[model samples]
Structure formats: C-alpha cells, structure tokens
Target chain A: MTPTKTAPQNDLPEVYIDDILMTLKYFTDEHEVHLKIIDPQVCMNCESKPCVQFCPVGAYRTQDGGTVQIAFQSCVECGTCRVLCPNSNISWKLPRGGYGVAYKFG
Target chain B: MSTKEKLTFDVIVVGAGLAGSAAAAIAARNGLSVAMIERGQTPGSKNYFGGALYTHSLLEIYPDLWDRKPPLERPVTESGFWFLSKDGMVRATVQGGKMQNDPIDAYVALRAKFDAWWAEQAKKEGVFIIPKTVVVDFIREDEKVVGVITDRPDGEIYAPVVIICEGVNNLLTQKLGLAKHDLKAHASALAVKQLISMPAETINARFGLPSNEHGLAASVMGDVSMGLPGLGFLYTGVDSVSVGVGVTLEALTKAGIKPYELLQRYLNHPMIAPMIAGGRLMEYGAHIIPEGGWTTMPKLYTDGALVAGDAASMVNALHWEGTNMAIMAGKAAGETAVEAHQKRDFSAKSLSAYRARLDKTFVMTDLHQYRNLSHFLKSRPDFMNTYPAFLNDALGMFFSGFGKPKKQLYKDILRSLTDRRPLVKAAGDMIAFGRTIMGF
Candidate 1:
C-alpha cells in the first residue's frame, strides 16, 4: 500500500545513533556530499513542506519559519525525502560506490 | 590511451545489485567478456531492503553457491501475517519446511553481504568489476547503445551491449530512454527499516524458533502504514531482527505521516513490543521500491541495451517479490546479450529474446495477473486502515464470547460491517478484492 502520512505520528524514536555508527563500517576515500537541495527558494515557499515531514530518518528539518537545514551525517540514503518533496527541491545522487552507511546487516 | 580508444569487453553490466551482478555472471559464465560497474565502494554497500532472498531463483542461477556456506542468517521456516488496530491484533500463520513436496527455502540474508558474495561468484566466472564508480549517462554512438559514462575523468567505457540494473532510482535508465524520466511517487513505495541487535538465543525464543534455528518473515498491516496500501515487516537475522514499515510516496504525502513514527508504532504495537524490547538499534535505511507492476513496466529492451530489476519496474508489490524477479530478469538479459553477440546483432530485435524468456517465466505472468492491484488499492484506501481495523474488531468481539450467544454475535458482526460505510460500496470493494486476486 502507498503509505499515508498525517496523524501527527512523528514522535521521534528514542534511539541513539552514536553507538550504532560504531559498529558500522565504510570504505570511501572521504565523506563527500551526495544529497543537496536544488532550490533554496522552492523550500522557502513550501507550505506543507512534505519533505521535512516524510523523511524516515529526519535528515531534513525546518530552519526558522522557512528555510530547511540538512543533517547529512545521519542520512540513511532511503531517497524518501527526494521522492516526496512537493516542490521538487531535492537533488539526490547515488553515493560513490561504497561511500555511505555500511550496514552490518542491510 | 583514453577509455574511448581502449574499448574492451563485449558487454558492460551497470550496477552490482542482484540484477546487475546476476547479469554479469550469466554472460561471463557463457564465455562472453563482461564488466560490472558499481557506484558504491562495494557492490551491496548502498543496497538496502526489509527483504528475504527467495532461494529458488538463486538456486537456479548458482546451484553450487548454496552448499558453499554463503553468508545467510537462516532459512525462514515460518511466516506470520498480522492485522493490527488500536488495541487489537489478529494473526494468520504458516510454519513448516515443505509445502506440497517443494521446500519454501527463503533465507533472511543482509543485502550488503549477499550481494558482495554473489558478485564474487561473478568475479570467479571471469566477470571484471569496477567499484565506487557512478554511471552518469550512456555512451551513445550512431543512435544505438554502446556503453556508459561514469563520474571519473574520461570515464566513458564502450561496448556493443549494456545491461542496466541500476536499481529503482538510477536515472541512467531514464537517460537511455528505456524508462520514463522523473518517476512519480505513485509509481513507487518508500521503505524505512531498522536493524536491531539481540542474542541469537533471544531472537529464536522471541520469534518461537527451535534452539539454534532461524525464524520467519513476519509482516503486519492495518495501522502501521498510516492508511496507505502498505505493510510492516519483522525479519529475524542471525543475531538481530529487522523491523520496518513501507508506504507509497503519494499516500505518505497525502497522509503527512513520518516514516519513523509509523515504524515506532509498529515496534510498539501490542503484538510487537515484547519481541524486541531489549534490543539495540543497529542500523537504519530507506529506499524507493518500484510498485507499478507489469502495467507500468518500462520497455525491457532497446537497441544494444537491456533493462532489468527495479529500474524496469519489475517488482511484485503484493508478494514483495523484487529480488527474485531481479535475478530471473538479469539471467534472461545475460542470455539474450550472449545471443546478440553470437549473431552480431545489437538491435532491439536481437535483445528482445530477454522479453520472451520473461514472458514465459513466473515473473511476467505473475506481474500481468496482478497489474490492476495498485489502482484497485488506490480506489479503496481504507483497505489498509478502516477495513482491516474493522475485521480485527469484528473477529475480536465474535471470539470474545462475553455473554452473547452465537446467533446474536453473528448479527452484531453483520450490522457492524454496514455501520462503517455504504453497503453498496462495501460490496464493490469485496468484488474488487475477489476480481483482483482471481485475476478477472
């Protein structure tokens, strides 16, 4: 089923990522940028700002009443924020082979 | 010399996931030179899913890989489905090894480990692999397909044929004009999953498996997806259990629910909380799943190129059958590439033998049979929310057997069904369900 969104279900889970990242591994030359917002203006005008709410891991968050702030450090690369962005504000690229999160159990 | 001038290999397989790796292996094993290009540091590092690799297709591809102790969590010997409401849960179960003389041998292996291992097998069969490279576009010559252009300097790699298995979101397939550009939310489902660590004994005990044995792929529906036509899953790994939920992007946008909260709701469901109470959160992942089935699948073959796996919209949403389809389609593409090479024909006609193989297999037939399911689901969005919840309530009350007699209980359930919606619409949904499943 295409999952529906609102009931204000976004109470964040009380899990810590610092511990999780300790066990995970990766083999990239450096932690380079892979995801970027295409248009700052598009994000500023988004009323619903669906991308902020729909991302599974909260990679995106609201800054002030308008702008969007990104936390790429914990991004899981699910492509949810990119697909659900109502304003087409997201530009997602595949991380260079073996660049992102290394799943101990993907 | 430059990549353009140093042409080699007859075929280049793009992406090293299940489909690309399989295609590379299949073509190379048949004595054709193949090069597999992966965008991740390794083949499966960027790959993720709440998935169980169905062994039947893999066994057909690599009969020997199974006996060599491939990195597998466990053979899912049991399975369960749940209907969850606010305070109620209803479950249906299937637990056994043999079903009608055939074994249900699905193993819950992590994709990172499985794909990496599977690609090694391709390497063993003389398939060359280049990792950490992204195929930015296809190298077009005289309007026919040739090879791929990667992110590296002078990254153009040329060949007579190229197979695209770059997964659900890669734009290379779109650039090649094999698939529609800008895939919409309705065409895909979004998945959010977490790996939770626990003791192997604890996993077995909680999931009701024999000591030192594996568990089942447990899936639940109703409220977990927040009313989208989607479901939640709990898969038992060797020392961890993966729990998550998925919904279509359109549904997710309309409902405005966050994916993690839906996951939290599933984890905290009355039936699920106890199973992973003391576990540690190990990993989190999200990916777009192709759900358009057969009706919306892109063209399978074009001049000098073939597309397979999620990139071609080759997933069966109802059965959660992506990996199996990917492997089979990849195999077909490999064989077809070999045939095209032998005949020295790189046109769409030569590569279309892949389509014939797919049409004759379970992949295409099953997809064609269930093509209308996504639309039917959209028509009755309540199938995920209101109806399933009602089913739970009705069944709960009927079985509660408080003070009412059986006849009185039957009447109550009948009245309740009509109380929710117009009886005519309910009947239409019922008919739709039957017709969709029966493939009418």
Candidate 2:
C-alpha cells in the first residue's frame, strides 16, 4: 500500500496504474479479444506510440520488439484507443454480453 | 442461451442509459410495445459519469421523481467553480438553504445505482428491458433501420422503429454512415475518475456540508489539467467523494500525457489534497464525452431510425450538462416514435419530427447558444493556462499590498496584464470572447 512513486518536489502520492485498476471490477472474456491491432506492422511503422500514453488504464504498452502490446484484461472500456489511434489500426468492439468492466459506483 | 423464436416490438432502443430508458419508458407510457437492450449486466453497470444529475430533465419523464426516492447520493446545496493556478486558487461558491428544499436543482448520482433504478422504473412502465446484451449493428431493410442485431446467437430483434442512444463511442451511428467517421480526438475527451469512500460524518466536516443530505459539486479549470482544454470535477456523495479530471484526447495525444497520471496529480494538488486525504479507493472508472457541440452533431433522424443522447453528440459541455440533454432528447424521440406509430408511417419524413421537437426545446437551443465554446477553448490554450494564472498572480499582489500605496498596487496589476500578453493579443481575446458569448 506504499506510495508507488511521489510527485516531484511535492508530498503528493503517485499511484501506479495497476493500483488504480484493482479498484475496478471486470468480467473478462478469455476466448474473445475485443481489442486487436489490425496490423502489428502498421503500429511498428508509426513513430509515436500515443496509445501507451493516451489509454487511461495503461492498457497499451510497448514491448521490447517495438510492437505495442495490449493488456486488454485491464481495459476500463473507455474506447479511447478506438478513436485516438492515428493510423486507425485498432479494431475495437464491446466485450460480449455480461463481460468486461462493471463499475460498482459508476 | 439461443432463441429460435422471432422477437419483435413496436420500438427498439439501444442502450439502457439515461436516454434509452427514458425513451423506452415514454414510448410504453404512450401505449407502444417497447424493448430496451442494455449491454451491461444491468442498465447502469457499464456506465460512468462525473456525479451530478440535474432534476429538471428527469422531472419531465416522471413528475414524482423525488417522491419515489431515486438512488440519489446527496442534494447539491453548494456548487460552483474553483479556478486554480499551480499554487493557489480563486474559488466561487454559491450555496443557500433554497437549494436544499424539495424540487432541488441537482444531486450527486452514481450511475451504477441510478441507471439500474431507472431501468426498473422503465420496466414498471411496461417496457421489456433486455439486459447483458450488446447490439452489434442495425437490422436494415430496404435502406431503412428496422431493428437491431445483438451479440447473442440468432439475436435479431425487429421493430417498426429504432432509437439509438448508445453513448459517445456511437459505433452504430457510424456503421450506418450517419457520422462520417469515428469522432476525432479533438471532438471528445478521455475522463478518468476515482471514487474515494469515507464516512458520512467525515465528508460533512471536510466539505462543510450543512448535513449529510447536502453536498457540493465543484468544477475546476486551469493547472489541474496542466493547461489543457479540460476540467476537473469533485462531487460529494453520502459517504464518498468523486474526484476526476477530463482532458481533451487531442491535447493528451499532443502532449503525450497519461490521463490517470494527471488525475493523480490533481488528487495531490495543494488546493485539492486535503478533502479526501485518508479515504479508501472504492472504484476507478473512465468515460468518453462528446464535446463537439452543435456543429459536430450528426443527423438526428433517418428512415425508420432516430438517434438521441451522446450518440447524437447531445452534450452541452460548457455547462457540464449531458444527462439532462440526453433525457430531453429521449423524451422527444419517444414522443416522435409514438406519433409515427399513430400515423402508421415510419418513414424518414415522419421520423424527422424528432429533430423538430428537439429544436423547440432548450436541448437544441442551449447547444446552439454554446456551439462555439468547445472550439473556442480548444483553439485558445491561453484561456485555460495564462488567464487563470494571471488572475491568481494579480490577486496575490493586490491582497498583499496592504503596506504599499494603493495606486502603485493598481499600477502593478495593470503592468502585469500587458506583460502577460501583447495589446493585439488581448484585443483578439476580447473579440473571441464576444463571439463565444454571442455563439455565432
């Protein structure tokens, strides 16, 4: 429960993405991946991986091979990557019925 | 889990959020067979909002709203703006006993509870609510929408008319080529919020609420979003607080800033840190808001189909109003559907009544009035960054000028204004401000 990191020059606590995601509830559809990269090569040719920064839940990450990896399990279903992707490389759809994030106090 | 029987209704409404439920409820009340399809396990399970619900819109659907005891957190007795700089803030709060009375203006609402209660009410009105079902696309016939295709096996549900209230992502609207493309990043925002739980007594004391029944709704601008065209919101619930930030996706992408990181920074702000210091995190959520105003709104009606709520980009962003707009639009759409049924004509020409009805209400008028606000804020970064900081600096110098000559203090403030921006830039701001106000 310790502060993951501290804000520079301030006493404010910096919370990690995982710590935040733990507060949410999700019913994952293990068989079906709702979010997919239409082409990994399209993502690689792109210089700026804005998805890593723009995703509110940090669902998109950069792998060592320079490909963007999607940790869709933790996605809050905000639909940011579907629209914000510069190359429109994301093929996004809602999770199956009774699946995906369910907010207890949304 | 699969049904071979044909399912049909007079009207099918996608989504069970504020707009969908309201539309279905009204359509049923008008004696039409209605079905509301929800993607979540329940109506509200997949929803998230910034926590304030205005009463005027809901009252139009249910006159006895407060009497039924909806799932309201607290009546908003105090609300206003907190213009923040990095180190200081200028707060403007409007509170009174009048706001605490019945028929109150607004309340803090948790969508998970509120939307569920709304669906229950819609069911009471004889609307069949299909839960845990996602509508994949419209069931089109002869270039007209006749029903919806859900994710379930053989899940084709038919109806004479379809109303799409499926929120800001609005894939269904795009599939029909109503909107040209997915909303650009600049037209929408990525908002992340955290619900921090505390005792009711603790919340009362921290927020200076008169009692547990009273609450505060505050909107913040300036350094909270790091000078982006965004806003920060804090709403007091019965025993929890909702604190969040919504930054334009365009700005976030351009700046390469993580929205959650910005939210963390907001939580620790000097002006904001103390309120929820020791509370436990209850839930974290995010949502997309349509901030494109009137200009970006898609065509509201087509043959045998109509769009309402965030699906039509019906958000009055400057006023922090969306649910109210959605509810109003839903009511209109429902009435229009009932009218179409009465005439036995479900053509594009007949469904155009939805837009005509909306045009007569404040939903369209207010949106038209504030049409330029989103564009104005996005185009001018200084309005979000430079002006608030300058106000704080000027006020800081003036307040501490007790020992100095008053005239000299006035002179210093005037000097700082010019030093912040050239005369031409200031004049440009004045003209732009006029245009934004006039909404040309």
Cα lDDT tens digits for candidate 2, A7-89: 22233335588988998899999899999999999988888888887888988988877788999899878889988899999
TM-score per prediction, in order, is: 0.93, 0.95
Q: How many collisions per candidate?
A: 17, 0
Off by over 4 Å in 2: A1-14, B1-5, B97-102
How much lDDT does candidate 2 score?
0.88
Query: lDDT at B225 for candidate 1?
Result: 74
Per-prediction DockQ: 0.50, 0.54
Please give the C-alpha DockQ score of model 2. Answer: 0.54
Residues B125-216, candidate 1: write the lDDT tens digits.
Answer: 89999998888888778889888888887788888999999888857777877776566678688888888999998988887888545567
- State the TM-score for model 2: 0.95
Best by TM-score: 2
TM-score of chain A of each: 0.70, 0.85
